[model samples]
Target: MIKEIAILVYPGCMGMEVFALTDLVLMANHLAKNMHPGKFSALRVKLVTLRPNPVAIAGGFKVAAQRLRGKPDLIVVPGLEVSRFGEWDERFARLGQELKAIRRFHGQGTELASVCIGSFVLAEAGVLQGRRAATAWPFVSEFQDRYPDVQIEKDAVILSDGGVTTTGAVSSVMDLGLHLIRESMGSAVARAVSKLALIDGGRVSQRAYVDTALIPQNRAPFSTQVNRWLAQRLSETYNLCALADAFNVTSRTVLRRYRQETCMTPLQWLQKARIEKAKHLLELSSMSVAEVVVAVGYHDLATFSRLFARETGQTPGHYKRLFQGKRVATFPRG
Candidate 1:
């Protein structure tokens, strides 16, 4: 049996997300043929668009997507490069006819899945409305604001609810493809595909990739200075009272202002900043985990390890190993 899958393409879509998923799904089919010849022809993937028109993706390249031939068993909606925070809804709304087509396909029992910011399209189309979904962690706030009924799980790498599946961050689109393979074939096929694709199978969250400093900090001028001050000295010990004194404000005032601007208190931001710095050191420098703990202002290795694991969903060593030579992309937290 051939399981048909459609990968939706549109103008300004993330080319990498679309390309990676297409390759992974095709690789799964290739592996299946070699591993279980004559019995497995698992997936048939199509790059689809609303019409047979050329679409400009994020990069400089342009490609034509195939018009919908028939109702596919699964539809993969790929994310786009969001230049600004509020543009997703407008972009998706302009494709209202396509959104309607997606909903109709879902009505016909075609499973819907979204990658990263593509959740906005699914939500706008009403396919993911009132359901738990996952998308790029940075866009969680805006996504929730746009669709109040949709529960946004920013931490999870992938989430499946009802008939819609969503994956967090840009790279997890490949993970979502592998997940589809696991669902359609089995774990054995999925594992083989992962090995062939060189995809790490342990990515479960987007937390480790989150750069805390990049998170939006809409605050007062004085609070902005304080945030900068905190960023400069992530390795130093911090106290709310001392921070308030250094900034010539009462502790209560400091806490209130920071919370008002950043949506997080000073202490929470400080911890996040430390973790980010630690992540940087672990990835770039050949620092041991214990050295990293002390360098990040934590004295107890066990305490740092626990906090690191809790915040990033990976141990210090595991986190270091994950990005040893890889370039960590900075995702804007809108």
Candidate 2:
């Protein structure tokens, strides 16, 4: 089956995911033709616009887009490069035609999809209204404010709900590509594409990319103070009694309120804060895994490793390597 995909391009669309996803689908086409000619065929893909003009993208690049001809099997709304926090309004003001097209296609039962903040576009078009969508972690607040009717999940890397599929972050483009292949082309072909393109298919969350310090913690005065206190004492052993005394609240009241605010108890919140700090130190400092464990209040190395893996789906060492480490330039000393 030939899956026709229309990549909706707009001014200031992020170019990386657009190019990466197109490349992946093209590779899948090649592999599918060679491997299973009788079963599957080349997927038809087109960069499309409401008008027959070159759409400006990020990095000052432009893509020649064909006038949208027909309702495609899938319409992919590409993420925009938001220079300012409140640019969603500006973006939508210019995308009146694009939004109409999306609404038209979706009403006709065509599936809708998005990459990163492209979910915002779908939300604006009302296709994602009252449906859950996977969105970029950092922009959840803005998305909620704009589209309070839509439910957003920040952790999921890829989500399919109510005939709409969405992915988190810019890098989730490959994950989305692989998911489409697995759903339409079969797992065997998806595995082949994964290996051929060297794209990791194991990513399931945006947790690794999250910065805990950035999460809004000031909804209530008590939660704000608790977060601040926790941030400073991540290296200390978790003591519920001491926390209650410091806040002048009873131990039971502390646990109940913290859980009510964060959906996590005091101990669980402490653990999360510690893991986030450990991730930060590993990415930015020259700290060894053992040192990181100690710095985060974990006494046992094996326990810390297991906890880290459970929390982020990657070992501390692997996470550090995947992020950054203190390493000198090859063949040159600093």
Quote the lDDT for 107 in model 1: 86
**Candidate closest to the true structure, highest TM-score:** 1
Q: Once superposed on the true structure, which residue ranges of model 1 sit more than 4 Å away at CA?
A: 325-334
Which regions in candidate 2 have their CA more than 4 angstroms from the true location? Answer: 37-39, 84-86, 213-229, 238-269, 284-288, 300-310, 315-334
Clashes of 1: 0
Q: Mind sharing the TM-score for model 1?
A: 0.87
What's the CA error at residue 164 for candidate 1, in Å? 0.5
Write one digit per residue (lDDT tens) for candidate 2, span 52-159.
Answer: 577778878878988888778998888988876667887789888889989999999999889999999899999998899989988888888899998888688999
Clashing residue pairs for model 2: none
Each prediction's whole-model lDDT (CA): 0.83, 0.85
Error of 2 at 214 (Å): 5.5
Best by lDDT: 2
